[model samples]
Structures are given as structure tokens and as C-alpha cells.
Target chain A: MFKPFAFTLAAAVLLTGCSAQSGAETQGGGLADSLPSLTGDYVWTVNAQKSTVKFEADYNGAFSADFSRFAAAIKLNPDAPETGEIHAVVDLSSVRADDKDVTNNLPTPAWFDIKMHPVATFKSDQISKTDAGRFIADGTLTLKGISKPAALTFDLKTDGNAATADGNFTVNRMDYQVGTGSDFKDESWVKFPVKVSVRIEASR
Target chain B: MSASVKSTYTKTAIWLHWMIAALIIGQLIGGKVMHAMDPAPLKFELYQLHKSFGFIILALSVARLLWRLGHKPPALPDGMKPFEKIGAKLSHIAFYILMIGIPISGWVMVSSSPYIIETKIFKLIPVFDLPGVPRTEGFNALTKDVHEYMAIAIAALLVLHIGAALKHHFVEKDDVLNRMAPRIKVRR
Candidate 1:
């Protein structure tokens, strides 16, 4: 009876040990230990000349627009990415398209409704390093008074004192009440996904 | 063949003529209505469709011109006066020129437009801008005026052409109208 009890204890210990080892390999470390921390903070100012927010939407074909008027506040430490905070505000009235008609319609009530909601904003709550040279910002995007969680994955390249972040994300126009009750309401005419690309150059 | 019978237009010419006529009429109405509407997504889409149809008309006009060069149209009714025959010939020539000119001018307006949008035919075939056309507000305005006026001229000429055809059919009671009719029998 003692031998059987000893074997059961040994088997239990062996199984627990194997599970612990596999868990470590999968997670790299415990949740608390894996959490990133900030080392230093740097103030970043956007270079307007080199920064632009571009959006693309599909109808019968693909159409794109560029918004030149936007502001970004980024506080980041390359060594400790967890402390970074990024906030951006885009002026909806500044949207411009290659076609004059499309440009004119962008700010109308059926679309961006610049008269009511003139600005779209994003505030990042957390920033985490996903891989080498890449980071993800978990944030809330508020447009047309509706706030929703959005994650932006971007690649950061720093050249001495200057840094550039290029990233892209997609949002459903319907979620923001844009293009509602218009001919664009039908997905066949205008698709739901509106892809937004960002190319921002900032300096300390 | 009976002496009283009249010759008819060739099948290719007949089809081209009718197709171009229908498209031109539709485009004229669509263009005016779409332009008058306030800027919206629907208006924008309609403009694109109008532009695509304009390009199609341009292609058909080129083919019609080639067909006209190789094949002769049926002669005017012998009862027509000398001046009437000359008028008919001049009008037909004017029709051909305007049919070709309207589309080309519209194309020039689009090419010179300051807005750098791609013109896709039926949202499928991509059309490049005309070579050497500067994309500037002044240039586009000039081309737009030309395009609009030329379209008006085409519309006026169409009214005359249709009225004359109706006159020939009802008043003159001749084969002038029947010669281009869809299913009218013609002598060889």
C-alpha cells in the first residue's frame, strides 16, 4: 500500500513539473514579470510637413482622401515602451479627395458631419512592444460622439533625435454613424471598412 | 429591283447610328440632371457613369467614322431640290463632326481638370488623361466651357435632324425616313 501511494505521489509531482515547464515556455514568464515598464519620458512634437493621415474606401472602385490637419501628442521612452501615451486629433473638415465632388461631400451631414463632429480623436491607454521595431497601442477612438476601442500597430524608426511611426488601421464607417441613410448605406455601393493610414514624423 | 423602291443603310451603319443616337440622348439628359444636383455620393456616382458612357460614345463614333469612309450612305430622294440635297449633306457632315467633337472635348475637360481623379470606364477599364493637357483651374474652365457649348450645339443639331426626318415621313411621304427605318424593305 505504501509503494502504491509513493508511486501516485511521484506521478503527480512529475505531471505538475512538466506542466509548469510548458507554461513557462509558452508565456516566457509570469504575468507580473512579463509586464513592460517605462524607463524615461521624452516629449515628441509632430512635424506637420511630413505627417499626413490618409483614408481609403471602396465603392465601385477604391477612393482615397488625405487629411493634412491633425495634431498628435506622444510621450514615449524607447527603452520602456509601456509608459508611452499617444493622443491624436484629426480635423474632419480637412479631408480632401482627388475628386472635387468627393472632397465636397466628405464633410456633409451624411458623411463626416463636420458641422457637428468636426474632430476625430484617439487616446492610447497602453502601449506594448509586439516584436522588434513594432509596437501596438491599445486605445479608444472617439468619432461622432461614439467611443470604441481601437488598436494601432506601428513600426517606429528613430534617426537620432527624430522618430517616424507608420501604421494603418481599419474602421467601419457605420459604427461612427457616417454614411448612414445615404446611398452609401448599402455596402454594395460603399463598403463598410474604411482603411486609415498614418505617417507621422516627430522630434524630441 | 423596282424603280419606286429605296436603298437602305448597311446593317453595321444602321446599328451604329441608332446606338450612338440613343446613348447621346441619354447622356445629355443624365449630364444636365446630375450637374444640377447638390454634391452627394449619388451625384458623384452618376457623374462617373456619365463619363464612362461618354468614352463609349467616343469609341463608337470612331468606328462609325471608319465605316462611313469605307461604305457610302443611301442617296437622298430624287424629288429633293438642289438646295435640299446640299442641306442634307451639310447636316450629315455636321452630325458626324459634332458626334466626334463632343466626346473629345469632354475628354479634354476631364484631362485638364485640376482634380486628380482616375476616370475608370464602367469602373473597369482605366482611361489615362490626354497627353500634354495641363491640370489647372484656368485650363479646366476653358475646356469645360467648350465641352458644354459643344454639347448644346449637338443638342440643337439633333432637334433639326429629328424634325427633318419626321417631316420627310409625314409631309413628303417619301422613303427618306423609311431608308433608315429598322425593318423597312429596300431594293438592292
Candidate 2:
């Protein structure tokens, strides 16, 4: 489902305008946090070996895969998470699925279209701490040349200097045309919703 | 000659025989079509169906083999030479091997694949992968090649199997084909 470039450009602008307005409102009022130890402005270094970004595609059973290469830039004083930003970039070409066919199909035009869109990026417009002591990052995910609203909710656990954040979010593959067109339009073969889970181990 | 009498197959045996035959034929064709097509959602669906039918064929083969063990099949038609009898027995053995081997190899191929895809029969029945089977590229490739070649072997065997049956019915004018034939009025 290739939307015209001109039309999508206009839509992108409109979506961005809405996100910015909502972001401002959320940031102005949502700063309540209870995790005092996590309240710091230190730039954490992600331990690549310990971090994993995986997505599951439901077919017969879930066809699970992980992006071998991904990076996250998180600036946060967990006590005032509203002022922080969460930016993540995943190299889609580095996706490895447990099924060879799925791994091969992911880069094709009907799937991730890696040749055209090699990287999927998420930039948070607003970050907030929940009462349950978890954090949520409201962001725009740019994937396959299309941008859509996405949110990542994570539980941040700090051990002295090291921090581990594990979270999961589901995205409809149909929205970004990840697995659309031909027979994939139906949910029979491969389901539409792809659950993306992330574990980031980082230290200041 | 008394050991080589002709008799119609039992109804259960005949049913399992024909059901497996029909499913095997479908699986063969589906396998070929799916292998030749480019990777797409339809191809994926075909692959799944192929696996489902493969499992069905394997299960029916097991049942047929078990049934055959308990209930003796009609012996070879009278007037057949010793060599012919041995050939028929050996061919039947080979058929059983392929019937079971092809599907198992396919199962192993999927199981040992580095990209862990769960096997579900007809998208309804969830089948687990071979336990303790390490997921390795080499193992997966070996099993894949074995599965494909065994399927080809079965195809070749089918030509001989069907041709021999046809020969028995038309050229030899024997009850060999009719023994397994569905609802043939064998007036002896």
C-alpha cells in the first residue's frame, strides 16, 4: 500500500503537528515520579551484548525474530521523566528470524522493504512515569518510510551504576505496511499485530 | 502358490490406503509448487498446507503399516516368479521407508532451522519441534536436501508402483490390482 509521496508528506506534517501539541501538554503537567535513585541526568551506555530487541509474528506459532543491531539514546531523570527524551534506532536489515523463509521475506517489498527503509526509528514526544512505578514513552515510530504513533512502556531497574529496562509493545503491521499486500492482507497466514519487545541493559 | 492367493483388502486397510494415496499425491504437487514459487504469503500458506498433508500422510502410513502387521495383505497373484515376488516385497518395503522417511526429514528440517518456526497442522493443531534437536544451518540444509530427494524418490517409486499395478490388471489379466481396488466385484 504505497501512498503517494506528496499526500504522505502532507499527512506527516499534520501528524507531527498533533504530536508536538500533545507532547507539550503532557510534558507541562506530567512529572510525577517516585523513583529517587533513578533521578539523574547521566547519559547511559547501552551494553550491546545484554540488550535485545525482538518482534513476534503470529502465524502457525509466533515467528519470532530479533534485530541484531539497535541503539537507544535515553536522557532521563526518572523523577522528572516528562522532560526526558527516548530515541531508538533499529537496523531492520539486521533482523534474524528463527524461520529462514520469514527472515528472507522480511526484507522484501511486501514486508520491511529494507532496501528502501533500512532503519526504523522511534523518537519520543513525551515521557511519563506511571503510578505503578513504570515509565511510558510516547513517540512517533518511522518504519518503512511511514510514521505512526507508538508508545513503549518499560520497567527500569537500577543496580548501583547499571540499569536494565525491559518493556513490550505491540504494533499493527498493517499500519506501516510491514507485512501487507498479496495474500498477507489477510490474518490467516501471518497475523497483523506484531509484538515488539525490548530489553536494554545500560550503565552511566 | 497357496501362499500367493488373491483376496480383496479389508475395508479399513483399503480406506487408509486410498486416503494416504490421495494425500501423498496432493502433498507432492503442493511441495513442488511451493518450492518453485517466490517467497510470499501464498507460498507460506502452501508450505504450511504441504506440511499438514505431509504429517497426515505420515500418520496414515503408520496406521496402514500397523494394520497391515495385524491383518495380512492378499499375497502376490499366482504364477508370479520368485524374483518377481522378492521385487514386489522389496518395493513395498521401499515405499514404506519413503512414506515415513520423507515426512520425518521434513519435520527435522523445520525443527533444526535457525529461524525457529513452530509447526502447526492445518493451522489448528500445534506440533512441537523435535526435542533436543539443535538448530543449525548444516543440519537444516542436510534435512532439507534429504526431504526433497526422498520426495523425488517417492515420485519415481510411484511410477513403478502404478505401472506394475496397471500391468497386472490389463496385460497380465490378474486379480493383483483388484485386490486393493475399491468395490470391484471379484466373482471367484
* Per-residue lDDT of model 1, residues B1-188, tens digit only: 54533277878888898999999999999999998986567887898899999999999999999999988888888889999899989998998888889889988988886554678899999898899998766888898899888889889989999999999999998978777777655443
Per-model TM against the reference = 0.55, 0.55
DockQ of 1: 0.04
Task: Write down the C-alpha DockQ for each prediction.
Answer: 0.04, 0.04
Q: Report how far off residue B70 is in candidate 2 (Å).
A: 0.9
TM-score of chain B of 2: 0.93
Off by over 4 Å in 1: A1-204, B1-6, B184-188
TM-score of chain A of each: 0.78, 0.79
* Ten residues in sequence with the least summed lDDT for candidate 1 chain B: B1-10
Clash counts for the predictions, in order: 0, 3
Share of native interface contacts present in candidate 2: 0.00
Write model 2 residue lDDT over A128-202, tens digit each, in one string. 878544777788888999999988877777666566677777889899987665557778677888888877666
Q: What is residue A77's positional error in candidate 2, in angstroms?
A: 12
lDDT value, residue A129 of candidate 2: 76
